[model samples]
Target: MPTRRYDNSPGLGSLYARTVKATLRKAEYEPDTDGLTLELPRALVDQDHLTAYREVTGFSAGPALPVTYPHILAFPLHLDLMSDPSFPYKPMGIVHLANTITQLRPIPMHAELSIKVHSGPERPHPKGTVFDILSDVSVDGEVVWNDTTTLLSRSPGTPSAHADLLPDPCLEARAFWDLRANLGRRYAAASGDRNPIHLFKLSAQAFGFPRQIAHGMWAKAAALASIQRARALPDAFTVRVDFRKPLLLPSRVQFAHTITDAATDFAIYNDDTTITHLIGQLVAR
Candidate 1:
């Protein structure tokens, strides 16, 4: 990918200064390649949590959440930095233009895990700024999964109602319905997120699943659909979701939406009713 360069526009100059000051004061500032360790809670894999994970990641009849769930741990770090009083922007105001997850291993169920997060400097774009975050999720001191997430914060000169508002509840939405296998294939084709655990029985079983699973984004898309259908709105708005847990395959995952004046909240649950996944807020453009 090409490196994003600073625009040097008046607005960008102002936003950059504010971002630098806020980031400098409390930034994780940990050196690149230096690892910070965090003890992962057993509660994160508790039976109840597992059930929710299975439902949300579409692993009900299959394996545990794809190795991707741990990637979400880094999101809190972004929240911490964005929420700092000195920070120039509110995360809710930013648009999640794109997200990609690359998995390294199969995260075992019922295992204690550790995580370390590293974030790079702001990479500027013509319309916004992009930052890169890398996280390593380990178990018993051995690296089990490494993930990267990118977030884009649009320039204030860009029109947005959420500029200063804090994140609020998200509206609910459903996913487009298709054959299960077709849904899996479509997402893989579009996302280049071809995890075998979501493709074939033998492939999934090799990864500790009883059956094939669904991509995490599919559930997110479903949630977005549910919200759009309920409100009868167009599909051009912005969305930002935190993948709290996974949803399993071949199960009915119920989606609920709650919209406040400022934002929308969407949650997905398994048939057992555990919160398999949660989307913090979806902003209407």
Candidate 2:
């Protein structure tokens, strides 16, 4: 299949509108037999976007960009692929189940990056079906950042793929925060992910959420930011996060971690109930 190329990242406003229309149409979309690849020209990270992202996630500004930064760069392509007529599922209802990001090396802020995104074939899952959206960022032909984001779409008639497992509560929280309702909107604005489910109470209600919910990536980034503040992290490492429950807007949550020589195990939970919202680990590479 021919690789789709874009001269510039599509505007988030247009992408979100088109995705909503596609979801409402519910056209008989088909998955690409051989999958799809999207490539974009060499681009520089925007200083304003970086500043906003850092302010929202608590990441410090430095010569190197955060490991998850490229994920934002690749997001528009992910949306484009999902909104394609040949894509198998609607963009709205699909759940972001998990994400793993590996930084092969530190990426300099001045380096120009070429981003490529691939939407892989769907495979049977206990809930219904799941697929991988893989993204890679390269500088001068060498891949410096890689990410795999897994999404699940539930089918009413399909049998569950596996038993649901809840993560055990961490012994205690090392830090806590009262996340505001506007957090989702802030993160969306910085990340270019304008999914309605995370935007506002009214928009979320349309998608069956009681209130606006935080973005999983935002939660993960916040946790990383907290951890990085406490200590230095390896230049090359992998961070994997499993999103267990939605973090409702304007909520209080605790961050916990257990550090070892190889990796740091972390979890975010409701400060009052101890319910796990996300479980993850950061392993030195």
Candidate 3:
């Protein structure tokens, strides 16, 4: 398929403005297309941005780029595709239900890289409609990293009888993180994912949230960070996460993991409650 190429990155403010209008207009659902492909210019990693990301997520500053960094680079394009008028659903309240990242190999710092993003067709889900956004990163024509992010748009519909039942909690927390109120802003600053709902209370209220919420990806990264601190991760592996609920800003959360020869099962829960915020596993590749 012919790809759209952008010389300059899309502006976040304009994209958010467009999303607001799109939400209020209540655009009708359109049939999903083959999906948009976006190719970004080759660029070197910015040291400052890398530093901030490392500090916030606790990823080590090293020769290899953190596995999740490419998602940050492709984020603007993801927003562009979702905010387009032809998109079937409003950008607001779209839930990031799951994400799976496959690190083919370690990506070196300062390497000039190319990124391509594909927003896939929407599929039926128990609660609503779901879709995949796939991203691929390459260096010198060789694909180095990729990710598949699944999102959901809730609508009036019958629940799927085939939905997988939730797994029973299997482990207790090994660590806890007391996330600060500015977590959303701090993450947004480093990741370039300044989604309004994550930035501040007013912006979140506009989107029907009581207060600001932490980014799902940030929470995932934080979980991985904690896991890495406990044990070294396999170089080639898959980290998958299902975001059950939003982690309210400035809240304390618990993390636990059950490790096996092939994979590790992990979960994040509300510090004072039994509610699961996210559940995921890391599988050896």
Best by lDDT: 2
Model 1 Cα lDDT, one tens digit per residue, 1-285: 111122221132343355445645644333332333223332244555445444544443224344334544344444443544533444443444334344344566666666555555666655676665555666777765565566666763344322222243443334423335445655554433455676776877786768776766566655654564576432224455555554455556666677766667666655554454554455544
Deviating ranges (above 4 Å) for candidate 1: 1-44, 61-64, 72-74, 85-88, 156-285
Arranged by TM-score with the best first, the candidates are: 2, 3, 1
- Each prediction's TM-score versus the true structure: 0.42, 0.94, 0.92
Q: Model 1 — which ten-residue stretch has the worst lDDT?
A: 1-10
Candidate 2 residue lDDT tens string, 95-194: 8999999999999987899999888777777777888899999999999899999998877625645634335635578888899999999998899887
Better of 1 and 3 by lDDT: 3
* lDDT, model 2: 0.85
Candidate 2 clashes: the total is 5
- The residue-level lDDT of candidate 3 at 151 comes to 86
Candidate 3 residues lying further than 4 Å off, grouped into runs, are 26-33, 164-169
In the range 250-278, model 3's lDDT, one tens digit per residue, is 78988899888978899999996588999
Candidate 2 wrong stretches, greater than 4 Å: 26-29, 157-160, 163-169
lDDT of each: 0.50, 0.85, 0.83
Q: Which 10-residue window in model 3 sums to the lowest lDDT?
A: 157-166
Q: Name the TM-score of candidate 1.
A: 0.42
